[model samples]
Target: MNLNLRHAVISNVSGNNQGQLQDTIVDAIQSGEEKMLPGLGVLFEVIWQNADDQDKQEMLATLEQGLKK
Candidate 1:
C-alpha cells in the first residue's frame, strides 16, 4: 500500500476557509504535540513550494533569526 501524505493533508483541510485554516494552524502549533508536526510540515511544504526567491530568502532569514534567538 502506498500513502500520499501531502495529498492526504490537503484533502483533509480542503474544506477549510481562511479563518478555519488559521485556527487549525494556530491550534496545531500552540498545542505543541508531536502528532501535529506532520501537518505543520505539510503546511510548510505548500508555503515553500509557492514561495518566490525573495520570499524564500526572507523565510530563511527569519528562520535563521529565530534560531539565533
Candidate 2:
C-alpha cells in the first residue's frame, strides 16, 4: 500500500482554524514524540509552499537562530 503522507496530513487539517492549528502544533511539540515529526514536517511544507519571499526569509532566520540554541 503506497501512502502519500503530505496529502493525508493536509486533508486531516483542511478545515482547521488558526487556533486549532496552533493547538495542534503546540501539542505536537510538547509531546516530543518521534512519530509526530512527519506530521509537523508536512505542516511546515504547507506553510513553506504558501509563504512569500519575506515570510520565507523570516522563517529561515528564525530557524537559523533556533539551530544556534
Q: 1-69, model 2: which lDDT tens digit per residue? A: 125887888898999999999999999999999989999998998899999999999999999999999
How much is 46 displaced in model 1, in angstroms? 0.4
TM-score, structure 2 vs. true? 0.92
Residue 13, model 1: Cα distance from true site in angstroms: 1.5
Tens digit of lDDT per residue, candidate 1, span 1-69? 124877888898988899999998999999999988888889888889999999999999999999998
The C-alpha local distance difference test score for the whole of candidate 2 amounts to 0.91
Residue ranges of candidate 1 with Cα displaced over 4 Å: 1-3
Clashes of each: 0, 0
Clashing pairs in 2: none
- Which candidate tops lDDT? 2
